[model samples]
Target chain A: MAELIFTEDPEDPRLDDFRDLSTADRRPDRPGGRGLVIAEGTVVVERMLASRYPVRALLGVERRVRDLDLSGVDAPAYVTSAETMASVVGFHLNRGVLAVADRPAPPVVSEIIAGAQVLAVLEGVGDHENLGSIFRNASALGVDGVLLGPGCSDPLYRRSVRVSMGHVLRVPFAPLDGWPEGLNLLRESGFTVAALTPRPGSVPLRGLREKVGERVALMLGAEGPGLTAEAITAADLAVRIEMVAGVDSLNVATAAAVAFHEVAATR
Target chain B: MAELIFTEDPEDPRLDDFRDLSTADRRPDRPGGRGLVIAEGTVVVERMLASRYPVRALLGVERRVRDLDLSGVDAPAYVTSAETMASVVGFHLNRGVLAVADRPAPPVVSEIIAGAQVLAVLEGVGDHENLGSIFRNASALGVDGVLLGPGCSDPLYRRSVRVSMGHVLRVPFAPLDGWPEGLNLLRESGFTVAALTPRPGSVPLRGLREKVGERVALMLGAEGPGLTAEAITAADLAVRIEMVAGVDSLNVATAAAVAFHEVAATR
Candidate 1:
């Protein structure tokens, strides 16, 4: 069971990891200066404990700490008043609990794709909330894993973790190093890389299921700019979700869910 | 063509329709104390001009106003400095433009369902962002209309309009007055009202296409407490998007997109 230490000082050095979290994006403790994998609220903290990331410590109000099932938790859980906790964190967090975890080395791209039926390959998805929503959608819709292409944000960022409702901790993701050129690896491994774009001549997403075989990789780019010419050209085929004329395309995460349901849900 | 009137004062009476938008939710000019339909950004503002809602006025930076094709717009366009616009709206709006419109009487529920082949029936989806996202997804995925059941929020809320990318104005929606019992109206109109739930014995969303006929009304509830037992029991059939066990359910809007792609996109 985790040890519950009572702390009243807002400036305690023991609570350094929990300080000024509003600016946590630039924490030096994280990989490449991106913040630690911080999980807020009981549900996400519990998810972090279950994940491969190594948990360091926890800070929470008494009621929130008491509500957690810490039988398997090994970290020191600090119990503090909400006011003290808020002062320490630099803002009032309605979730009341937070856990920070060390970033584990990501799996190799091949490892994530091995034996997987479906995968989501994202490029230029730089928004943390969108990245988090994609992870949540990927997990719920049965996408086997996610591959980060060029310009993708870290899914372990604090905001991403919170937005994903902890699903980011559960989903496996790895970086695909070679950008558009790296897509050939999926092709070599028997996966059809389908780029989602609105360009004419692309197949509608609804008809895609009938054409693809055992393995499929759905490549998506950020909204507005969409997939680059090089990325779209490198894919095995291009597909689009038919939409009303003049309307903006659906948000990236929502589009991914539609594709995941059509391509991965039952597989 | 719309006339552009320059305004330097933040308190100009002509700009009242666009003032204090953060608290605009309770504007007296709106029907029943709800705010007017507000569209932010050039795209959304253009959509508002094209919508059935009667435009009251527009406030925008000179560059943004000049970019709009206001050939058919008859409302006064108030061009102002970003600082003045910020002072009036109570915050800095990066979108650079705003348009407000009076809420027209909603079309009868029967009117929205009359010619629609696919529709969305919502219950307890009170989150403004979620409601907006659902509208955006509904427009993108070809869901023809939306019917709000009990516990649903106003889709015309400012946040909803912005998050939806103004698609809420494009999608027709009306309240289904009699709650779960009112769902029979869709049945009478030759539609299969399929409730989306995770209950056992529910048909998988993938196979649902084969089971349902031409017309389908997808019934969805909010995220946590999904469709009540009564709501699920009232449907012609219950269906679920297949998901990994022990993972959280997809966000209500994302799930709706998945279901919409499965049942409505092709139709």
Candidate 2:
């Protein structure tokens, strides 16, 4: 079980990990200059406890901490007044609870591809909210894992964690280095890479399930400039959600959800 | 063509309609204490110029105003520097354009329903962003119109206009008065009112496409507390998106997109 510590001072040294979260995504001391994994609200905090990321500590109101089932947790959980937490964090957090976690060693791409029936490979999904939404869709639709290509934001970022409803922790993700070249690995693993684009030449999304039912590594890009030319070339086939003419393309996350449902439904 | 009149003063009374947008949604002068239809960004501004809403005025940078194909537009198109625009609106205008339009008389609920093939009926979707996204999805998926049930936010609000990518201007919408009682009017119009719920007893969404073709009206509620008991009971059928176990429901707009795609596919 976790140990509960009470603190009143906002400047307490032990609370440094939970400080100034608005700019927490950039950490000078960290290897990649990225912040520690942060889980907010009770639901996300519960997910963090179940994830592989090592929990560093927790800070929350008394009621929130008492609500958590702390068995097997070895970290110190701090109980602080809401005002003190707001003072320490530099913002008023209404989530009432938060958990700070250390980043774990990333899973191997091969491991994710090996066990997956359906996978979502994202490229240029730089927006944290979009990346988070994709992970949420990927989790709910039974996409086995996610392969993050270049230009993708950190799924463990606090905003991403919150937007994803903490599913980023529950879903296994591994970075796929080397841009389009890394996509070759999935093809070799008996996976058919289906690149999602609204291009005229691409097959409709509904038809994709019939074309590649064995295994699919569904690729998606950011909303505006969709899958890069080279990325499209890497995929086995290009698929698009057939949409009305003249209307703006669907939001990247919403489009991914629609496509994910189509692919997952038949599988 | 739009005549661009340059303005240097931030306190110009002519720009009051575009001032302090954060609080502009509530207007004491307008009916129901709601603000005039406001559009932000060049795309949405152009859409407003083409909509039925009477253009009141426009505030934008020179480049943004020049980009709009404003032929036949009679509104005062004020050209201002970004700094002046920021001072007037209480924030930096990243998109560098704004347009205010008088709210047009909404179509009658029966009129909106009479000519519609596929329609979205929303209840308790009070979030401006979600409301806008639904409009965007409905337009792209070829839904003929939208019926605002109880507790829906105004789609003409600025945030909704921006989030909808201006599609709210093109698609028609009207309020469905008298709660679930008005739902009977939909059945009278030869419509299959399908309520979207995650309830265990609800039929899967895919099956509903085959069951109700051509004239289907999909009803959706807000994210957490889904369709109310009264609303679900009013529908012809309750349909559900088959999500993986243990995961909470998708965002309201996202679930709407999935339902939209299903209906579109059938059409």
Error of 1 at A44 (Å): 0.7
Candidate models: Cα lDDT each: 0.91, 0.90
Question: For candidate 2 chain A, which ten residues in a row score worst on lDDT?
Answer: A205-214
User: What TM-score does candidate 2 get on C-alpha atoms?
Assistant: 0.97
Q: Worst 10-residue stretch by lDDT in candidate 1 chain B?
A: B27-36
Judged by lDDT against the true structure, how good is candidate 1? 0.91
lDDT of 2 by residue, B1-267 (tens): 567789999999989998999899899987888898888998888888888889999999999888888889988899999999999999997999999988888988888888898999999999999999999999988898999988998998888988998899999999998899999888988999999998879898865777985689999999999889999999999998988888888999999999999886436
Clashes of 2: 0
Candidate 2, residue A86: CA error in Å? 1.3
> Which lDDT tens digits does candidate 2 get at residues A1-267?
999999999999999999999999999999789899999999999988988889999999999999999997889999999999999999999998999999888999899989988899999999999999998998887788999988899998889999999999998999998889898898888889999998879888865677885788999999899899999998989988888887788999999899888887535
Two-chain complex of model 2, DockQ on C-alpha atoms against the true structure: 0.65
Q: Tell how far residue A7 is off in model 1, in angstroms.
A: 1.4
Interface RMSD of 1: 1.1
Chain A only: TM-score of every candidate? 0.97, 0.97
